[model samples]
Target chain A: MNILAMFKPNRDAKHYPGFGAVGVLFFTFLYLPILVIIAYSFNSNRIVSVWQGFSWQWYASALQNEGLLNSLRVSLTVALFATLVATVIAVSAALVLERGQNVKHAKLSQGVVNLPLMLPEIVFAVAILILFSQLGIQSGMLKLILAHSAFCIPFAFLPIRARLQGMDNNLEQAAQDLYATPLVTFRRITLPLIAPGIFAGSMLSFVISMDDFITSNIVSGGGATTLPVYIFSLVKQGVSPELNAISTLIMVASLLIATPCWLIAKRSR
Target chain B: MKKLSWNFWGLLPAYLVMSLLMVLPLLIIFYVSFMTSDAYGGYKAIFSLQSYSQIFYTADWDDNLVLNFQYLKIIARTLFLSGATAVICLLVSFPVAYYISRQSNNMKTFLLYLVTLPFWVSMVVRVYACVLILSNDGVLESGLRFFGLIGDIDSLLYNNAAMMVGMVYTYIPLMILPIYASIEKLDTRLIEAASDLYSCRMNTLRSIILPLCKPGIVAGFILVLVPCLGTVLEPMLLGGGKTMMLGNLIQNQFGVARNWSFGASLTVLLLCIVLLFLMFQAHRTSKLRELS
Candidate 1:
């Protein structure tokens, strides 16, 4: 839009706001709702109507809530188990994928792995629901774990693959020339080198599985509702100060969990 | 002894796992989409074009069939919403990313973490918070009324606006990270050179930075748009299920309506559309690079 003006102009960096006025407004729009949400969390109103006053009562209630805690427990466990499986698959796949040959077919494998990412979570969830039902594997912790792992593997693979592709190829070659067995080389040399990617990818998978609602909704089978499903039921069933408190508690919980990953991705960079 | 291909003999564990676990379920969807519906609920093994035809044509059923144009409209809306959201996300994230990129290293990392924090929270919770904020008699409605900004009440929770808000919330970070990475990679000397040559700042920006950043913009656009397009939960939970997206329509067909073929068709069509968008984006980047 500003392609023609560089030929003659005094520097007016301050006068011309770098992004223009539209940009500031955009940031405001992007941020205002979040600030409002944070503020409203303390509203004394049990209902979502206008706030009367502020109090810590909602946070207090959220802390005491057992149902929310149980749901969180389920979600965390699912995320943990799913990430464990996904990390193993992803790290191995990354090793195989980073071998720097069969590039065309390798791309196909990537596409196949990423297919779940492209498909709607609801559709994936629905498909898994149908598949599990047909196979007579009733929905439970096991199904949730497997379903989440299936979806999480791709995310886990991409970063690990990225790091493997970006790293110095000489290390592996040098280890091979040293008479180290491939397995031993991988365990000693490659794994240590790519550990950061593994950690980041695993964390990413864990967060994704934790946040997943659609697939969890489909496969939940009324017996093992995750926190997201619990929140959905809350919104549909009723609204109260309790739900608000729960939302606040979630904010705190995610903030707590995400902090470490955030720091890792930060300091390592 | 030889070049071991990535997918060679040693990697059977991965190939077997994904092929069996992830690949099999989708293959099941493919088959289920082809089978004919049964008398009571499930499908029979009869090879029939009846379900596929019924999605577009009405001759498959006795009397209760409805024209499937509604599904098309829903798909259109989904595309429109996703596109609009992606464009808006780009506009919003671009400057923020640029400004953040120009900051010191510590500030940049801090800003990046801040950008990522909201995203780590559950999508369901975020949508629920949006619903809380926008529901009738909710914070927004009464806030407006309390200040006498509007004399009457209006609901925001179940509208397209709410859906966009939810979409933007989830995807703004996706948009920002790519653009920021690209911006971080930008050569500052070019900007200084343009300044040294007394080139107008806007001209330098238009001629240099934007073109250089095209790849990242396209990447960010796709990262934001694709998943947002297929969102069903956001529409359902935040938009109150009042408006239907293609994802919702497809889900309804498979779940409630027992029209697997139609849903599969919808899903396939949407995937094609996504592919087209990505191709178009890639073409634009290549063209822009050529011009520059």
Candidate 2:
């Protein structure tokens, strides 16, 4: 039966039309919702469902909204701090894991660095919440920054580690042979080579921290609420055109942050 | 080897952060899971096995345990939904990924970028957009009405079907990327050779393409399945809180229910299941890599 089926003429043969149609449909499914959100952001109607006419009222309101602006400030501060801390830690850890002489512990450290990527975000949030409560630590912006940086480590580490692995060590060796100090060799030879990866990693981590919700929701206090948490609370209330406007702005910010990193990654590849 | 190297000391900052924030919290959750719940919404310090037992059997008023499957049902439902989402994503993404892979270099990059573009948008907003599209008088309903398929605006939100649509939509890119990566690396000569030998497309795909793409299929399946298992936002928004998945249950325990110990136990159970699945996937992929 298997042999007969194999030898049978393929009805679904290498037909480009069918495959192309599926591709078109898949892309449509992917983008239609996003496009709808962007389009609705301009709707003059207070209700998102009704399209009265094109208007910039929502955008203007979102821009002037104090709460939204405050959350955006909180989110930006957290993302920047987390990205900075995570990138530094990631670079140091990647250096040890990739370029160090200690081979046995490298695998252990590598696993630890990547562990958060595999764990569910909820578990991470819940665990951190539990730990903080048990330790009498308060949930606030500081705690949120700490948690975000922890979560962002894996994202930052991955690209930096990959760059370190691909790097040629001969230049550093040659620098050392030229009587340059280890710090000097690192400054002149190693840092410049891995700068792009570090930059990309930082950008990626920044965007992730900015976009994160679950951990922020669990860890952020009343005054420390981030944009996603605010959006989530608004969503719980009901759908509004204001959400559409704010989401569009967020989407623009993320694209601006992510596109350069994506281009850098593509070029590096 | 036990002694720290000079370079190893450089890893101290990361190690400290992970230990404090990641590893310590995980350990604390494990500890809390074994403790008893307090009257108020917190856990008592005393060790007890009550939370784990409550997952399967509940104590009756007569001091006898009765078989309870409410939590079990939620877990099973979660598993079923995750499995279905993985399967649907696999089916839809495979052909799309293949199509993208077969495109020209510039076209391939553009298509891949389009697939990943949605990911840059906030997931909460994307899910909300889905709500708008699937709501009564929403795009799907209006489109159906326009075609005379339905006489009235039908609400599709807050149903399993809507939840499934949202899950598949969110995760299809995850499924596509890995499969595309594998398929893109496939040698074109192999397909040409199979056709030259009078082999049908079925045989070529079956014997050549599928086997080569097994690793990717496995990766994509794991990627989609594991996250879907723990999805809370999608189910909450799309299922309208009518359906209780494991994620929602866990979230409830931590939030409204205030049963931290029980929530911790549920999280532990989920972690174990996810870890087991990941280990199995790792073993299978390693073996597959060796075979190929």
Candidate 3:
């Protein structure tokens, strides 16, 4: 049977009017903005909307821009370190919470862990600014690293926890029954099983750390600036083909990183 | 204390970081909000209520406070924008989500993936795209002119309508995903059963689908509304900083105004609104559990 035949046919399935049209429109609404930037990035005209001819000069200029490159370096450094720290912390916490045994205050701990996901980004930004200045922590790079990792822990922790919960307990138990120690069992059995989760979690945190604008903008404080902060300042100066080129490049990079994690998550489910 | 497992100690690093960074900082904001701002753009440690009081009343040259509606107006605009965005997202996403839920399995997966794809892109980049499209002689204006929708029009940027469009575009996915999750779990048999009982499409949707998907709708509403309230990019890029939302208002105090105490107070107020919504959601969840 075909996919449609896989489910029982319903008479009312086609009754909803305008839904199909709306779905098509929704996809267009989602993607058209990105397409506009990508298209204009290739335009040779200085005017962003008018297309004279296709050229790569915009990309060439963007690549050579020293300030943009510095910000990109800072963003990459922050994302890399933040992802590593967040994933390790997340995996450790997930192991304790999802170990198939009742842990004390698990609910409360989980709530606290997820609180960052709920609170407004502005609140975290201003609060972290206050925290750092009051504590006299003047390193902008250090502030970005700590603040990014703190919020990113929840993003990393969630997937790892979900993976742990979905794991089969029998494999670990069998290893233990075969005279494996807890450490051996974890290394030989549990760790391998949750590796995909760890990978997914790390990618997610990396994206979040990189995507953060407000927090980084607030806390970077005259020391270092990330790509988003840099982009915001450039945007305030007004739009240019160079801005379009840089934005398109960032969009492409984000997609390239996120798609693999998405495929893994889809497959695991 | 009971003997804790060795494995439990693994949680220490995360807990310590969270406590120091997330929890402590928020508490500091609360404390700093009650302090007085010194002339140097920093706070004095003296306890004062000037920050909180400034929200409703401003001290005039004569030192007598007049009732201030400026910040209150910003708060009202923020609420209206966020509320309108949530409702529009609901109306727009519900049908799309329902359509996806009714698709074949492979089709469903692909469509859902498409919906989530935009979220991976940087938010600043996405908002910048709005600038490219809506500015003078931008794609939107050019497209309109091509279709002869108008004789001449200036840039459509820097307006509340543009801001709303940008917000709905950004957040519609959040609404779609949760609503799809709930709708996917819904038994298709019920819809068939309703039809078998001669219920019309409108009644079946109203009486059956709507009630069943209420949880998803609520979840989507909170997800959309909260971010919209704290949004800074859309207002900055699309609203052209002419319109001030709560997020921009808070950022201003920290940026140009240098009143850290007042900024902290505004943040505290935003935090209270967020907490109230979360508490309401928790109460709803417990009630849902009891019902089920």
Candidate 4:
């Protein structure tokens, strides 16, 4: 404002054709590859490298790959189960942690909850591998659920904790004074208020579980493979159009979940 | 008032579950790292100083452990790249965020959603897109050649630079969200007040706006740095498999090497470094809050 007030208005926006060109280029560079991946999914040629006209055969073939489809199903199933389990633990932990009076211990509890996230994915993967092996627990769907659920709790807790921090205790106290049971008061007051944070946390946990390769790769035995591991293995073999097709599917799935949340967050703000 | 005791008991299930699932397993990892290797190096009950000693005593661990320095170099490089990413995101997103924040209801929401559109997509898929474009016959490589900007086909898929590109792409949303939050919190009148004082755009930005936004900047830095430290997979896939980054090494120990103890130490070391970074970040954020 001060600079504009002291001088004549300068509409330099038109003067430099290439002034913001760098940013435009940056956006294009960042986005163009993603656009190409979507575009080339229709490539009639088997080569991911060259465009030899367009067709949807790859998608049809990708869908027909039972092994790939099975893993995708497994990933989604595990992610869904993990999210629900994590949500319950996290919301409860967040409530108790927040409602409690001991600030020091609450912080410690927060630290412990976030511990799984801070540890390298490798360490957790190894720890679980050894722990499970020693227990003689066979690797299967159950093992993945157990392993993923361990990490998901913290993801569930962190956002809800943030929401919990901002909450006033008075509302709950008022409910208590009015003779409502603790359970009823919680449902009527705390849950509704913290619903958004729970939603955010669930979304985060689902994404983390769905995209997880390291822990799932390590802990789960040969029987189960997630989408990421499948994609990684196929990529190592070289980028088959099948892999490209799967990538497109994953891209679409993630985008589908993310777009709505983005809109909700933006609109709320 | 109802006693707080019963309510406090509600915390036990989560607390016990996390401690057993998380903390105890860590303890076991540290313990197993000390267990002696069997006759075939497969199974043993005997404790050996071998694993710990080998990391420093001889080439057995020296080769892999020394790789830490190389990976540390990569870690430093990754952090630098993330820092550059953070700075780039901050600069580019700030004005746009400011303008959006200043806009009327629906347009602002619609445009902000536009900014977040790509984030909705799986980051892995987007990263794979980068691979597709950078590969030998990928679009960008041929695009560059087609434009006559290069004489030969260039393959840019696997390298630290490409790794940085992936890291930046993954984290830009992180950087943006905080800056947007900070920008959103600023009162409209502050700009008007600065204008009343005849403050120039550059001066107001330097003295007033930037200072107020320091907390957000610090928060964004922590968010980026924490992930950058563990980003071995991105460099592995995107940088080409030749890059032996720390996360990859830690991953390999459990995967191929089967060395649990050494991996645990390396993980603990990384954990400590992140904790230190976060401590500094928290201090900066609190101080900035006090200043503004």
- Give the DockQ (2 decimals) of all models: 0.42, 0.53, 0.67, 0.38
Error at A6, model 4, angstroms: 20
Docking quality tier of model 1: acceptable
What docking grade does candidate 4 earn? acceptable
Model 3: per-residue lDDT, tens digit, A1-269? 68876365445543587788899998898889899899989999998877899999999999999999999999999999999999999988888787736578888778777879989999999998988988999888899999999999999999999898887789998997999987898898999999999999999999999999989988897569999999999998888999999998998898898789889998898
**Which ten contiguous residues of candidate 2 chain A have the minimum total lDDT?**
A9-18
Query: Which runs in model 3 stand beyond 4 Å of their true positions?
Result: A1-14, B1-3, B145-154
Query: What's the true lDDT of residue B187 in model 3?
Result: 91
The positional error of residue A21 in candidate 4, measured at the CA in angstroms, is: 5.8
lDDT of each: 0.76, 0.86, 0.89, 0.71
Q: List the residue pairs that clash in candidate 4.
A: A2-B199, A3-B200, B158-B239
CAPRI verdict (incorrect, acceptable, medium, high) for model 2: medium
TM-score of candidate 2 versus the correct structure, residues matched by position: 0.94
lDDT tens digits by residue: candidate 3, B1-292: 2225654677788789889998999999999999998767889999999999999999999999999999999999999999999999999999999999878999998898899888888899888887878888887888898898867855588988899988998889999999999998899889888888888888999999999999999999999999999999999889998888999899989888999999999999999998899899989999999999
Q: Mind giving the per-residue lDDT tens digits that candidate 2 earns over A1-269?
A: 99998666555444334677888999889889888889989999987777899999999999999988898899999999999999999988887777767456676878888878899888999999877777777648888888999999998999998888887899988998999987797789989999999998888888889888878887888479898888888877767889889888988887887688778888988
Structure candidate 3, residue pairs in collision: none
DockQ of prediction 1 = 0.42
Candidate 3 residue A29 C-alpha distance from true site, Å: 0.8
Kindly report which residue stretches of model 1 are placed more than 4 angstroms away from their true locations once superposed: A1-32, A49-56, A63-66, A99-104, A165-178, B1-10, B57-68, B146-151, B192-199, B279-292
**DockQ measured for candidate 2:** 0.53
- Candidate 4 TM-score to native: 0.83
Residue-level lDDT of model 1, residues B1-292, one tens digit each, is 2455434653565667667666677777677767776544456776776666665656436765667675567777898999999998988888888777766888777767777777888787777766766777776778888898866746667788889988887778889899988988888888888777888777877898898887889899998888887787778877677698877777776677766656665666666777787778869877877987
Ranking according to lDDT, highest score first: 3, 2, 1, 4
- Interface CA RMSD of each prediction in angstroms: 3.2, 2.0, 1.5, 4.0
Full candidate order by DockQ, most accurate first: 3, 2, 1, 4
